[model samples]
Target chain A: MTSASPILIIGSMAFDDLELPTGSAHNVVGGSATYSAFAASVFAPVRVVAVVGDDFPEEMLGTMRGRGIDVDGVERASGKTFRWAGRYDTDLIHRTTLDTQLNVFASFNPKLPELYRDTPFVLLGNNHPALQLDVLEQTRAPLFVVADTMNFWISGEPQILASMLRRIDTLVVNDEEARQLSGIYNIRRAARDILTRGPRRVIIKRGEHGALLFDEDGIFAAPGFPLEDVIDPTGAGDSFAGGLLGYLSNQQQISALSLRRAMLHATATASFCVEAVGTQRIATITREDVAQRVDQIRSLYEFGASTM
Target chain B: MTSASPILIIGSMAFDDLELPTGSAHNVVGGSATYSAFAASVFAPVRVVAVVGDDFPEEMLGTMRGRGIDVDGVERASGKTFRWAGRYDTDLIHRTTLDTQLNVFASFNPKLPELYRDTPFVLLGNNHPALQLDVLEQTRAPLFVVADTMNFWISGEPQILASMLRRIDTLVVNDEEARQLSGIYNIRRAARDILTRGPRRVIIKRGEHGALLFDEDGIFAAPGFPLEDVIDPTGAGDSFAGGLLGYLSNQQQISALSLRRAMLHATATASFCVEAVGTQRIATITREDVAQRVDQIRSLYEFGASTM
Candidate 1:
C-alpha cells in the first residue's frame, strides 16, 4: 500500500452479470470492494483486503492499481470469482435476485498484509457478523470503523450482530433493515433503538429518499439529487460507504463538520451510482465534479426573504 | 384585510384530538384550512373556504379572527366537524388511529366568497378532488396555484383525482402519496408519473429526509435541516404550504429559483412546526426568524470544491 493513510476494505470484488432493461451485460467487474475502493481511493490511497479467484480478469486488477488502489492484500486463489445477477423492474426499488455464485467467496478469509497493519480506516461490508468480527479482531486500533449489515445477519445471528455493532463507530443500514433490527416501524425510533446498542453514530439510508445521519446530538439528513434515469442500484450502499469513509480519511479531523461533509460526499457519490448500470457511472468521478454537483444540490435549497 | 395580498385556501378544517405521552389534547382546531390560513395570514390576508359545524367552537372562530383569517366562507351548519384522534408510541412514525370522525366533512362543498374569487393565489390542502375542482372553478386565473393531496384520495378517487390534477400548476405531496399516485415504486419514476397527470411542477416531501422538486426540464432536491425535538408533526404540512405560497405570492414570481427558495422556507417553517404539538410552535413565527433559519439551511448544502 502507498504511504498515505491506508483504508483497508474487507469485502467482495468480482463479476456482476446484470440483466438490465436493455438486456444483459456479462461479467462486469463489480463487488463492494471494487466500488468502495475506487471511491475511497479518490480521497485516500486504499488497501483492498479481499479474496478473488483466477477467473477474475487481470484488467480489473490493472484498473484498481492504475487508480492508486493497493490490492496487494486482495489474495488471488484458484477457482472462480464471486458473481451476482439481478434484475430491476419498473419499481427499481424492489430488485429480484436472479442468481448468486459465491465462488471463491465461500472460503474467503481476509488477512491484512504486514504493511497494511497500520491502516487507520476500515469498512466491513455486509457479511456474516462473525466474519466481520473476525476482521475487526485482526485490525489494529483503527482511527475510524464502520460496518454494514443486512437482514440475513440480523435474523441468522442476532447475538453476533449485536457484538459487531458494539465494536464499530457507525452502522450503515437500509430503512427496512433498521426497522427489522429495531422492531419499530418508524425509522426515527429505529435510529434511537440502534443508538442504544453502543455505536455512537448511525446512518439509515432510505434508498431513493437519500440517507440520514444520526449521532448523540441529533439527526441530519442529506437528500439524493433527483435523477430521471437510474438504470441500476446494485452497489449504491458500497458506493456510499466509500464516499463517506473516503472523505473522512481525507480530512484532518473527525469533528461533526467533518462527519457531516463526509455524509454529503457519500450521498453525492450514490446519486451518480444510480445514473447508470454497475460502476461505470462512478468509475470516473473526480472531486471537482462531485463538488460542483454538490453546489447544484445546495442551490436547490437556497432561499431569500421578501421584505415587502 | 391588511392588503398584502388576498389568499384563498381550499382545504379541510377539522378537529384533531391527539393522545401523546405528555398528555392528551382534545378537539383542537386543526387541518389545512386552519393551519394554512393562519400561517399564510402572517404574510397576506386569507379567506378560508371550508365546512364546519356548530360544534366547531366559537373560541376557535375567535382565534381565526384574532389571526385575521376571514372565515366568512367556512360554511357552519348543524353537524360535527371532522375529528381525528391518534395515539403515538415511543416511536412516533406509526401512530395508531384511535378514532376518525368524518363529521360535516363528509358532504363538504367549497364555496368561495366574492372577494376570494379574485384572490391572486390558491393553496389547496389535502382534500377531496371534487371539492378542490369546485374551488378551482370559482377562482379566476390565479398567479400561483399550489395543491396538496393525501394517499387516501390517490387510492380511492383516482379518476376524480387525475381529473383535478390537470388544473393545478404545482403539487405538494408526501413521498408515499407520490409513490401511490404514480404506481411506480422508484421515486424518479413516481415523479414522472405525477407530472404526466398535468401539473407543471411537483414537490415530493419525504418528511424528515427533506423534499424533491420535479419539473419538465429536470429535478433538484433539498435536504431537511435537522431538529433535536420533534414533539408533534401535525400542521407541519399545512405550515409548509403556508410558508411556500406566502413567499410565492409576496415575490410575485413563480420561477424555479423562487419555488426552490419557497421550498426551503416551507421546510424551515415545517421544522419549527414539529418542535411543539399541533400549531403551538407556529403561532409565533416571523419572517425575520424564518430568514435566519433559512440561511442556516443554505449553509448546510454549501462546500465549494476545487479541481483535484
Candidate 2:
C-alpha cells in the first residue's frame, strides 16, 4: 500500500481519566480524533480537526509531531481540554461515565484545512450527527467517507443520524447503536437498513466479541483475540475506527476483500489498544506487531472443510 | 448421509405470549422440550417426553407425529403446560419475562424408556439443575451428553451446575452465564475454564451475535445470520442447542471438523427459529432449508487465499 498523506480525522480531542480494575490511569491521551490520528499516523500522515484547551499538553503535540500527526486544525483556546472520568465496572465489557466535561470540546467545530479538504478519506469519529454532517460538507469529496456515532446520537438524534447517513459512504457503530438506529435486532438487518440510508457498507464493532462487515452481498465474522487482559476499554473504539479507515485510505480500495482485511487489521489494532489503559498500549506498537496479530486474529477463526 | 432416529425430548410443551415491535404472534408453540424436539426431529426421528393438560391441543402433538416425531413420551395429564409471557421493549434482542407459571411442569421428571435409553445422544433441557442431572443419570451412557442451564441455576446452585458439568460431556450457556459461571469476561479464557471443570467442550451462545466453541487447542467463531426483524427470540437458544447436538450425534464423529460443522448447523437452525414466534417457525423448517442456509453461512465467511 502506498502512503496516503493528509488523512483527515474530524472528532473529539481531549483527555480521558479512567478507573479500571487493575489500576487507575490519569490524563491519559484520549479522544476519538487524538487516538485515531496517533494510530493512523503509523500507516500514513494524519491530519486532525478537533479542539483542545490550554491544558492540552504541548508535549502531546510534540509527541504527535514525532509520529508525523498534523494538528493544524486542532485549535487551542482558553479553556480546559474535555475531561471524561469513567469507571469500568467489574464487568469490563460495559462502563459507566461518571462525568463528562466537554469544556472546549462542547461548542467546538471541525474546520478542514485546505490540504486536508481533498484528503482521500475523511473519518468522522463519535460526535453529534449534525457536526458530522457539517464536517462532511467541508471535506473535499474523496474515495470514501466513514462516520462513527454513539448511542446518545442514536436515541436522541436519530432523524439527524438517518439523514446524515446519506452524506457518508461507510458507517461504523457499536452493535447496540446499530440495532437502536435501525430498529432491527438482527445485526445483518440493521446494517442492511443503514446501507439503505446512504453508506454502501456498515461495520458493527462488537467490542470483545469482534466485529462484522456487511456490504451488498455478504457478511464476515471475526473473533476477537484474547487480550491477556483489558486494562481500560476507554478508547478502543476510536482506535478501531482509526485503524479501519486508515487501512482503507492507505489501500485506496473499497472492495469486499479490502474491507474484510481492514476489519481484521482494525480489530487487531484494537486488541493491542485494550492491553493497557487508554491509548498507551497502541502508541508505541509497531506495524510489524499489528501485522503479526492480524494473522493471529484470522487464524483464531480459521476453519477448513474436508470431503472426508 | 443416512437418516437417524433423534433423541426424544420430553418436557414443558407450551405456547409463548410475546409482544414485538415488528408484529405480535400469540400462543406460538414454545418450551424447552418442544423447541428441542422440533429441532432434533428435523435432522432425525425425534420422540418427545412430557405431560400436557387438556388445554394442550392434541393437534400440536399430531403435528409432531406428522413430521415423524414420536409423541409417545408425551403424557397428557391435568392443568396446563408451562406458560411464559414476555415483552420485547425496544430491540427484540432482550425480553423481560413478564410471567412464568410452572403449571404441570413444576413437578415433572423425565423417565427414559428402554428405547430412549439406548439413544446415542441426549440433551437435558434447561430445567432445575438437579432434575437435569437426574435425567442424565437415568439415561444409559449414550455416545454423548449435553445439558442446558439458565442463570437461575448458575447463581442459585453453582455447585450442582459445576458437578453436573463434570458428569456431562457438553454444556451450553449464554454469554453472561458463561461469564458468571467462570468469573471471566474473556470468552476464550472462560471457555478454557469451563472445559477444565467437566465438559470436554464449552459452547457460549451469544444470541444474535452467533456462538463460540472452545476446546483445548482451537477456537471457532460462528456469526449468526443477521436478521432484518426478530419477531420473538424466545426458544431460539434451545433450538440452537438441539440442532447442534442433533447434528453432531447424527454425524457421529466428534472430531474438530464435526464440532465446527455442528456449531454452524445449530446456528442455521436457530436462524430459522426466530422468523416467527417460538416453535411455530422452528417446527416448520425442513432439513434442506437448514443445509442450504448452512452453506450460505459458510460462503459468507469463505475467502480465497492468494498466499498462505
Candidate 3:
C-alpha cells in the first residue's frame, strides 16, 4: 500500500429506508458520512465527524473501524438516529423522498477531534451551509477542502451556501444543481459563472453520462464507467468526492495531472458504489479492486494521441 | 487534402423551418444528405443521392458543389421540396415536430450513378431500412459502410431494420433509440446486445453528453465538446456521421487507431453544427478550422497516460 494520509469528513451518519423496484430495505446503515468514509478508507485513513444515536448499530461502527476509519469524532447522542426514507424510480436516477426524520440530528453540532483539525484533506458532505461553515471554522489550515451541495440548500439557504462556497477549494454538485446554482443552461458557461462565485474548481456530476471538472486550467471530462447493472445509485456523488479527496491526500502535490488521476479513482469508486444496494458493495471492496476498476475506466477514454 | 477519397451519401434533401428560443427561421437548407454531404466534403469528395423538388434552391446546390460535394446524383422532381418544421424546447435538446411534408422525398429512390458505384466509402444516412438496403445493394465494393437510424424506423419497421443492420459495418443511433432497439436500459449492455444482431460496431450518440463506440476491441468514449451557446442542434448527428466516414475514407485501412481519429473529427464537426441555426457553421469552416477544434476537444480527455 502507498503512504496513506488522513482525510477528515463531516456529514450526517444515519439509518436509511430505501425502496427500489426490485425490493425494499428498512433501517439500512447509510448517510453521507457513512458512504464517504467507507469509500475514502479504500485509499487513505478516514476521520468521520457526525452524530449517531443510541439505537445506531455498534457492529457497523466496528466494521468501519476495521476498515481503518477513525470514529473518535462521532458523537453518540441520547435520542433516535437521523432517518431518511425514499423510493427510487425505475431508472434509478430519480427518487422521491417520502420522509426525513431528523431525530437526534436536528440539534447536532460537529466538534472535530484535535487530530482531525490538522488533517491535510477535508470533505464537507451535504448539509446545511451554516453547519458546513461551523465545521470549516473548527479545522486548521487544511491543504484542500471539497464540499458537496444539492438543490435543497441552493434554494432554501442560498446566502449561507454562497458564504460556504468561498471557503472551499472545490465544489462538487450534480448537473441540475449546477444549472440551478448558476441559472445558466449551458454547462460550460454555468461552470464558468460558478468559478466567479468562489470555488477554485467546480466538478459537475452527470450521474450516468460522466463528470466534468472545470477550473482555471480548463475543463477535464471523465466518462463514467459504463455498467451492465446498477443495483443502487445511492451515495454515488459522496463516494466520488471521498475517493477523489482520499486519492489526492496521498499525492505529493496537486497538479492538473494529479487531479486527473484523482478523478480516475473517484469514477471507479462511484461505479462500485452502485453495484449493490446501499453501501454493501463499496464497503466490502479493497483498494486493489478500486485500482483494477480505475484501469478499466481509463481504457474507456484511451486513444492513440501523440500529444494534447 | 490528405489524398481525399470519395464518399457516397444517401438520404433526404429538403428545406426545414426551425423555431428556437433565440428566434425562428424559415426555408433553411437542411436534411440528412445536406448536412452529411457538407461535413463529409471537408475530408472527402462527397456524392449525394437524394430526391429534391423543383422548388429546391439551385444556389444551395452550387454552394455544395463549391465545397467538393457532387450533386449529380440529386434528382429534381416536379413538385415542392420536402419541408419539415420543428420547434426546439428551451433546453434545445427536445423538439416537437410541427410538420413534415415529404413531397418529393416520399419517392426518394437512391440509385448510385455508374461513377459513384465504386466509391470506396459509403454513409447510408437516416432513411427507411428498405431504401438503405437499396443503396447498399448498388454499391460495387465499398471499403466501409456506416449507417444511421432513428426511433421512427426502430419501432415502425423492426424486421426491415434488422435486415439492414446485418449488412452494415456500423450502426449509429442516439441513446434512447439504442435502449429501445436493444430492449436494455444499460448502454454497455445495449451495445453488446446490438452487436449480436449484426453490425460489427455500434456508436450510441448522447446528444450533448457524448458518444460511445462499442466494438469487439472494446468501448471508446468521445466527449461532446461543450459549447457556450447552442443555437440549433438540427442535423448534428448526420454531420457527425459524415465527418467520421469521410475522415475514415482517406485512411489506408480501418483499425482501432483510424476509428478513434475519425471520432475526433466527427465530434469536432458536430460541435460546429450546433453553433448556428442550420448548417451555416459547418458549411463555412475550413479543414484547418476542424483540426483546431479537434485539438481543443482532444484536450478535454487528455491526461498523462503512457499506456492504455
Candidate 4:
C-alpha cells in the first residue's frame, strides 16, 4: 500500500424514507458508503466503492466530488436505487423497519478501482459479509482496516462474517449486534468475546449512551455529545465509523490514546449527523464545528484527580 | 448547622430477596438508607435515620457500626422490617419486582437524633417526598442537600415531589424517572427541563450507561465501568448517590470540578455494588478499592489533545 493511498469505503448508496417523532423525510439521499465517505472526507480523502441506480441524483455525486471524495469508484447501475423506510418510536431508540427495497443493490458487486487497490486505510461499512470480504480481497495490505456490520449479517451469514472478522483490525457494531454476535448480554463481556474470535479492537456503540472501545490495552469509554435536539438518527452509525476511520487514516497510527481521541471525533461527527435528516448537518459542518463539539465532549468527561 | 456534623441519610432499612441470573439471595440486608450510609461512610462519617423492625438482624446494625456508620437514629420498631423481592432479567438491566412488603415502614416516621439534626450534609434517599420533607424540616439548614427519587414517587406524588425538588440542591434519578418527571424523552432535554424546575443540578443515572450531570455550567457525563460480571444491580443507584454525596461532604465544597470528581467516585462505588446481591460487595469494599477503581475509570476516558 502506498503512503498516499486514500481511505477506501465499500457499502450501499441508496435513499431513505424516515418517519421520526418530530417529522418525516422521503427518499433522502442516504447509505452507509455515502455517510461514511462524507464523514471521512473531513479528515482524510475518501474513495467510495458502491452501486447506485441511474436514478441517483447527479447533484449528490457532484457533492461528493466537491467534498474531496473520489466518486470514480461509484457505479451507476441500470435499475432503481436501494431504498429503506423506517419509523422511530416515541423514545427515538427503538426503530421498526417498514420496508426495504433492494433494487439495484440486490445483485450488486463492489468493483474497486485500480488506484483504490493500494489504499492503506479501509472502512467496510455495514453490508453483506461476502461483499465486505470481496472488497478486502481486492485491497492491498492496509495499514488499518475497520469493518462495521449489523445483526442481519451476524445471524444470517455467521460463517462468512466470522471469516471476514479474522482479517480486520477493528470491528464496530451497535449494542444489540454485539450481543447477538457474542451471545452475551453484558456489553463488556460481549466485546471481550468478539475480540477473542478475531479483530484486535471492538467498539460497542450505544447510540446516545456513547461507545466503548475494548482492546488489549484496556477499555476506553467515550461519552456521546448531549444534543438538545436530535431530529433524525438515520445513518449515525455509518457516520461514526466514517469519522473514526477518517481520523485514524489521517493519523496513520493506532494507539489507545489515538483511538480515544478518534472516538470523540467520531462521536462529534455522529452528533451532527443526527441533528438533521440524513447527512444534512454533517454535509454542511466545517472542521471548526467538529472541533468545537469534540472540545465539548472532552470537557464533558474530563475530571481532575482528587488529592486524597 | 454544626461544622462537624456528619452526613445524614434517611430512607428504608429492609430485607431483600433477589433472584439474579447467576443465583438467588434471600433476606439480604438491603435498603436505600443502608446502601447509602455504607457507601457514604467510605468518604465521610454517615448518620442513618430510619426505622427498622425488631425482626431486622442485630448483627446488621453491628456491621454498620463496625463500618463507622452512626445508627443512633435507626429506631427499632416492634414489627417485621420492610421486605422486597425482585428478579433480574438475563440482561441485568430490566428488573421485575415480585413483592414489596412495607411492614414497619408503612406508618413509620423519621425522628433525627439531636446530633444528626445539625448535620451539614444530607442525603435524602429514595423515600416518600413527604417523609423526606419531614426529615429536612428536622435538620437545621444543611449546607448541601441531595435527593434521590424513583418512578413510583414521580408518578404517585408529583406535587409533593415537586415541592421536594424545589428544596434540594441536587436531584438524582434513573433515566425513566427523569423522563417521567420532566415529560421529555430525550435525556439532555429531560435534564435541562428538570434543572429549570428546581435543583441547581440534576444527575440522570442510566444504569449500565453511566450517568449525566447537568448544571448551569454545562453537563458532565461519566461512563460506567465495563464489568465482565454483574451479579445483582439492586441498590446500585443508592450506592451511587452515597458515594457522590459522601465525596461532596468530605470536600465540603460544591464546584464543577468537585462534582466531576464526585461523579467518578460515585461511578466506582456503584460498580462494586453490582458485584453482589444487595449491599454485599459495597458493605465490604475499602476506600483503597474505590480509589483504585476511580483511577482506572479516569484512565478509561483520558485522552490528550490531538495535534491536528
Best by lDDT: 3
Per-prediction CA RMSD (Å): 4.8, 3.1, 1.7, 2.3
Interface RMSD of each: 5.7, 3.2, 3.2, 3.3
TM-score of each: 0.80, 0.90, 0.97, 0.96
Candidate 3's displacement at residue B22, Å, is 1.4
What order do candidates take by lDDT, descending? Answer: 3, 4, 1, 2
Instruction: For each candidate, report its DockQ versus the true two-chain complex.
Output: 0.27, 0.36, 0.61, 0.58
Q: List, residue by residue over A1-308, the lDDT tens digit for candidate 3.
A: 35877999999888889998879988988999999999999989999999999999999999999999999999999999999999999888999999999999999988988888999899999999999999999998988999999889999999999999999999999989999999998999999999999999999999987789998778988788889888888898889999999888877567788888788789899999999898899899888998899888877766655322
- The residue-level lDDT of candidate 2 at A137 comes to 81
DockQ of 1: 0.27
Best to worst by DockQ, what's the order? 3, 4, 2, 1
Candidate 1 global CA lDDT score: 0.80
- How do the residues B1-308 of candidate 4 rate in per-residue lDDT, one tens digit apiece? 22333789998999999898988899999999999988988888889998899899889999999888989999999999999999989888898999999999998888887889889899999889999999999989889999999889989999999999999999999989888999988888899899988999999898888898998878888788888778888889999999998888777788888898899899999999998878878999988999899988877775645433
Task: Indicate which candidate wins on DockQ.
Answer: 3
RMSD of candidate 1 to the truth, in angstroms, is 4.8
Off by over 4 Å in 3: A304-308, B304-308
| Residue B102, candidate 4: C-alpha displacement in angstroms | 0.9
Q: Specify the CAPRI tier of model 3.
A: medium
- Candidate 3, residue A73: Cα displacement in angstroms equals 1.5
Q: Which candidate number maximizes TM-score? A: 3
Give one digit per residue, the lDDT tens place, for model 1 in B206-295: 777777788754675766775657777778778888878877777677877778777777888778887787777676677777778787
> Can you write out model 2's per-residue Cα lDDT over B18-115, one digit (the tens) per residue?
88876677776678888888887777777667767778888888988887777887877778877888888766667788888888887686777667
- DockQ agreement of candidate 3 with the native complex: 0.61
